[model samples]
Structure formats: structure tokens, C-alpha cells
Target: MIFYFSGTGNSAWVARQLAEGQNEELLSIAVEIDKNKEYKLREGEKVGFVFPVYAWGPPEIVLRFIRRLKMIKPEYLFFVCTCGDDTGRTAQLFSSAVARKGWRCAAGYSVTMPNTYVSLPGFDVDDEDVETQKVHNAVARVRFINEEIVSRVQTKHYNCHEGALPFTKSYFLRPFFNTFLMSPKPFHATEACIACKKCEKACPVNNIKVTDRPVWGDNCTQCLACYHICPVHAVEYGKVTAKKGQYKGRLLRDL
Candidate 1:
């Protein structure tokens, strides 16, 4: 079974590709394994995880899900993280967690995507082909995952993307970041918006509610789901971000 948690469809996109290529069952960590839920794993089943990288590590939701997960003893396990840049040492976080659960991590990888956490305005990745290349490369990475799983190679250590280190203390600096990043105040629809409601469906966490005016809740993780998925190029993070280049949720076929 392939388990996935995605906020901006990056992780989910990769997970679906891997499952399709490997002919595996897909499971959503967001809905299937909630705060209180049990997992059903058959003997000799292979388990995999695909999630987004956040703050140089796993997202808060991924960590919380891992903590609450009742994992079965799978014969194989793997992980893939969709990140904007090099996620140095962030992959190690998962290795440690799975170890604590008495589950061996077979293999892991990180793929790049557009950095959507708009609260961190400075962390922008403007490469036009970044998302497309990420999708293509992730498809190839599945081959490596399958090989490692077949070998039963347990990974105790994972590598980090170069220079992708944690800057400030998340506990202390996160509040300031979240205050501005997680709120609905920053996102405003322009006249270009048609109220298409694509943003509402794209929200993995269901943080966005579209009505006469869009509303966001404090539960947002700044994943930029709404901004990227907006079909009309209507959603934006304010004047500063609009100048930097607003995200309009471009896909491969959309090109």
C-alpha cells in the first residue's frame, strides 16, 4: 500500500504516479488515518509514504500522522518527499521516526517543486520547468524504490540536499511565520477571479471555503494549495508576492 499526505498536490501527484507504475494500492494519510484510526496491513505487504517537505523537515501533519499511525510489520517500506529545493537532513527525520516504530525504511528520495509556502516570501523558486521536471524525475525514481524494496535494504540514514539547513528555531520563529503565513489575510482574489471553486477542491486540508468571498482558517499550513490550483490566476498573496510571480497551478498538460 502507498500512503500519502499532500497539501499542494505535489506529493499526491508523485504518489499516484508511483502507485500506477508499481501497480500498488493507494491510501491517503489525510483521510484514512485520522487522529484516531487503526491500520490494516496484510502479511508481506509493502508500504510506502509520499509527502511534502516543510521547514527543512516533515510537515507538522506528517509528523502528527506518523505519531498516531499504528503501522503493521511490512516487508518493505519507502518514502518520497516533494520539496522546492534541497531538503538537507530533512529526509533523516523520517528514518528516525520509522526506526522508532520498529519499521525499517527501505529507501527514500526527495523531488523538487515550486515553493508554495508563500509566507516565506524569500524562498521562492521561479524555475518554469521545476514542477514538470520533478514529475518526470519522480517517475524514474520509482524504479529505484522498487529495486530497494525487492532487496529488503533497510536504510538507517538518509542524505540531505546541499545547504538545505534549518535557519531559526521553529518553536520560536514558527509563530511569527505562521501568524502571517497561515492566515487568510494575505490571500485576496483579484478581478481576474471567476469564483471557479477549483481552489476549494484543491485544498487537501480543506482550509479554504469559497463563497461570495473566499475565507481561510487558522488551520492552514501555508502549502499554497489554493494559490497554485486557481485556474483564473486570481488568487494571490498580496502586492509583494504578485510582483514576484503569482502561482496559477500549472500542470504538464496545461502547457
Candidate 2:
């Protein structure tokens, strides 16, 4: 089973591609976790994960979900990360986490995507040309990644780089971040808001609650899924973010 956790559509899109390309069944970790209250992988199935890289590491939710999961060792396991640049040292951290779980990793690869988080409006407003370049790059890398996946399935040997250090300021740290998240902050609508409410519904973490005014929840992973998938381009982090803008790592959409 291939499980994915995406804040933006990038990880989900990648997961979809991997599943279709490899002919593997696809599952959303958030959906299963939410409905079942717990999720476990079937034994003997090849397992994999695709997600965005945050602070040079995996998303907080991914860490929480993986830690809480119960699973038997798959014949092969792999992880793919989409980032705006090189993965830095976070790959090592991920490898260690899996090692502790006693599951061998098959391969870890990084792809580039447009950095949408920090790009500012009037500063780096979405550049189609740059985005196109990133998409092309990802397509090129995916071909090689497909080959690696095939080899790993055959050999059952893979090594992943450790990811970045977790931002552990203690339990209080999460609550602190939540304050900004749950408040009337960040999101700004473009002229494009069709009010479809897809953003509110798409939030797996329940970060966006559709009240009279959409309310953000405390527990958030900043996966950017809501932001990227918004059809209207109606979301913005803040004026500061509008200036700095957001960015994803190296991988762009494959097709």
C-alpha cells in the first residue's frame, strides 16, 4: 500500500502518479487516520510514503502518524520528498526513524517544486516560466526514480538520508504555533474565490472549519495542501508572506 500525507496537492499528485505508474493501491493517511481512529498496514505488502519536506524534514503530522502506526515489515519500503532545493540533512533523520522501527528502507529521492510558501505577491507572484522549468525537471528525475523503485523491489536494500532535526521546543511549541494558525490570520482571497468551500472540506487535519468565517484549527502541519489545491488562488499567508512568498523544493508536477 502506498500512503501519502499532503498539505498541498504536490505530495498527493506525486502519490497518485507513483500509484498509477507502478500499479499500486493508493491510500490517504489522513483519511484513514480520521475515519478509523487508527490505521495499520497489511503485512507483506510493499509500503511507501510521499510527502513534502518541511524545515528540511518531514511534516509534523507525518512524524506523529508514523510513530502511532502499527505495521508489519513490507517486502519493500520507500519514501519520496518534494522540496524547493536539495533536501539538506533531513534525509538522514528519516532513515533513523525507520531504522528505529526495525523496517529497512529501500530508497529516498528528492524532487523540486515551486516554493509557494515564501514567495511574495508583487515580488515573486507565481511565475509560469519558472514553474514550467520545475515541472520539466521533476519529470526528468521521476524517470530515474522509477528505475530505482524497480531495483529496490528486486534487491530489498535501500538507504535513506536522515532528515532535519525536529523543531522540539516541547509540547508547548505546538500550541504556540497553533495560536497563529487558529486565529483570523494569514489567508487572503484573490478575486478568484468561487466560494466552492473545497479548501474547507479538503483539510484533513480539520485546520479549516467552515463556520460563518472559515476558522483554522490549532493542530496544523503546514502541509500547504489547502493553499495549493484552492481553485481560486484565494489563500495567502499574510502581507509578510505576500512579500516573501512561498516556495516548494526542487520537484514540480510531473504531468
Which model scores highest in TM-score?
Answer: 1
Q: Deviation in angstroms for 187 in model 1?
A: 2.7
On a 0 to 100 scale, what is the lDDT of residue 130 in model 2?
79
Cα lDDT tens digits, model 1, 133-217, are: 7646655665665555556567665533535234442334444544545566777878887878888887777777888657777
* Lowest lDDT block of 10, candidate 1: 162-171
lDDT of each: 0.69, 0.63
Error of 1 at 32 (Å): 1.8
**Candidate 1 Cα misplacement greater than 4 A, ranges:** 114-117, 129-136, 159-181, 246-255
| Candidate 2 residue-wise lDDT, 1-255, digit = tens | 788887667677778778876667898888666454444555555677888776556676776667666776667888888776545554555667788888777677777766555523343424767777877776777777777776665433333333343334222343454444434356655565666777788777777865344556666666655665665556666664433434333244325
Displacement of residue 219 (Cα, Å) in model 1 is 1.3
Top candidate on lDDT is: 1
